[model samples]
Target chain A: MQVRFWGTRGSLPVAPKAGTIADKVADALVAANGRSFADKAAALAFVEDDLDFATGRSYGGATSCVEVDMGEGPFIVCDLGSGVRELGLDTLRRCAQEGRPKEWHIFLSHLHWDHIMGFPFFVPAFMDGAKIIIHAGHPDAEQALRRQQEEISFPVPFDWLKADIEFRTLETGREYEIGEVTVSVILQHHSHDSYGYRFRDRDGKVAIYSTDSEHKIDQMHDENDFAQFFGHADLVVCDTMYSLADSVSMKEDWGHSSNIVAVDLCHEAKARRLALFHHEPTYSDADIQRMHEETIRYEELTRDTDALEVLCAYDGLCVEL
Target chain B: MASTLEWQVDKRDGGTVVAASGRVDESTATEFAEVLGEHAETAGARLVVDLGGIEYMSSRGLRALTLAHRRGEEAGTKIALARPNETMREILSISRYDMVFPVADTIEEALAS
Candidate 1:
């Protein structure tokens, strides 16, 4: 199996080139601490100007989407956020290139706008005879899709789509076979109804994906839900939408986990690797890199028992499982 | 003393109905756990928690349920839930608690099994 992250930012889309501003700010901060008062003041002003420019670019986009390819099996795509539009187009290109039919299995974590916003823009769904299977937890799964199709929210109704779409309501912990891969769904705590998924191939390799889960301080001491959900998986793709400081001070109960929490869960579950996903939109590439480094240091200090590898996810990043 | 959250335990044909009311928050989770623990030893039969009247549940509430489930396993009793509301169902689903315990759509279905 191969896993790819098409979109990693959470809540909204992030600017593609905001790293330049972050670099400049880092340089300014470094210079300010090393220089005289006059130089420090000038550096601070430059930093403020760069931040203003960066914020404008970071705030204007959509949410998370990721794609997974199980070798010769079903095309499993997780979350249909704005990233799915690009993924859908990429899928069409891949199918056309490979001379195969367009078939996809989409697993939804929940019906939150940030998670499902890209459903309308998925190009293959507009093509005739394309087959799409949507697996979600809501009892009124079809109605949720139809609600998005309402004339008030979308210009084109869901009826305008030409693809053959089927909605399957999934029960937690029930394992189903899609081609050679066995997929299992687990429930996750979030603002709304959400699910975590585990996929295992015939080779016994497993991957668990979970996002939008809150890791409270108390959860650290208790037997966490993620620990059970991700037990012994080879790879875990998890929510790391906030830094530990940010998560503790501000984003508490916002239904997102910190990178440290993700690492801890990975450690507890004895997962082989951890891919941190659902980055805060405000995090520039440099900020994410810093967070990743800090998470590694924290993991190294706290992870006395497990040999877990951690990776930060970016748009277009891929991992072979 | 069995920690005191309000509960009515009714013996049925082949199972015991444990009807609990009020919010099962962190403060009252111990009481909930004690009730199930006590019932596990005395009932000596299948157990069904009727959660139709439960208005709210936190993670602690889930812990109590997990304790009951584990206790039932140790005691060799079948444990299930009857008539959980949409919110409760969602909580159970996300936490994967539904998988550990049988969830019935109705009391009759729960009792019959």
Candidate 2:
């Protein structure tokens, strides 16, 4: 399975400067070459040229859409935030290029606007013969989607979409199968109810996405909920929207977890890899790098085991398992 | 196991104040109902429930509170819920119990009401 991050910033979108990607790639190459003076100078020149090429706004086309390909006919997607627009376009392009119909199973975490705002803009829903199955935890989730398409808010009515779409409400503690993968849903604590999902492939390779959850101070250190939800998963993509300082102070009861809390949960669950997600919109790229460093330092200080690998998520990063 | 219900009563602001704590489940609902009946008989005054310490509640708990509310009504005494956390508040909102019993943001407001 391959997991790709189309958008990682939470609450809003952050556009990367044009040469930033080139600079990062060049820096990686230079570091691999043992940081010779010639390599460093060439990397610096490459970064400067890339920055000039990026002057006309070359980043952040969409919001928080992530695409997961589990080697199945139907692709699995999580959330429909503004990032879904880009995902939809990519899917359409893939279909056009491959001459195959696009099938998508969308798993929604909740009905919050930030989580659902990209649904209407998804182009495939307007395409003929497209199929979409939406799995949500809330009983009224279908109605909520329809409400967004009402004439009051949107120009097009819900029926105007040409795709064959079905909504299925999932009950907690029940496992649902899609081809070779099984998904289990766990009710998470949020201002409005939300769900965390665990996906396991036939080979027992597991990936759990448990975002938009606010953990109690005690739960952050305890392994109970983590073990039950994500125990020994190969990859855990978790919400790390706030710092511990913000979460304990002003953002208490705000339904989001801190990076430290997410790291602690990942460590307790014995997850092999942790991809810190839901980056606060205000966090710059440099800010995220600093957070990643701090998280590594904290993980080293708290956990003696070397099983944990923490990485900050960027908009277009991908991981295969 | 059958439900067990207990109520510790105190006198406050010329009214009968009850501090109800612990899980109000099926086994305790009947006992809770009996205690409310007895309290209404003795106090013959307004009632304020301090439910700050209740850790959990089910439909049976709601039923017990409703029965107590009816008893207060028959005895011409008012009953109000004082200082509920967000979880209890959600239960009250979802069950529409906030309309059945007066809700106070603070204990003083509950006692005064």
Worst 10 residues of 2 chain A by lDDT: A52-61
Clash pairs for candidate 2: A63-A83, B2-B27, B3-B27, B3-B28, B4-B27, B4-B28
TM-score of each: 0.64, 0.65
Q: What lDDT, from 0 to 1, does candidate 1 have?
A: 0.74
Runs of candidate 1 with Cα error greater than 4 angstroms are: A16-62, A217-224, B1-113
Per-residue lDDT over A111-130 for candidate 1, one digit per residue giving the tens place of the 0 to 100 score = 88888888999998898989
> What CA RMSD would you report for each candidate?
15.1, 12.9
Q: Which stretches of candidate 2 lie over 4 Å from their true place?
A: A16-62, A99-101, A218-223, B1-113
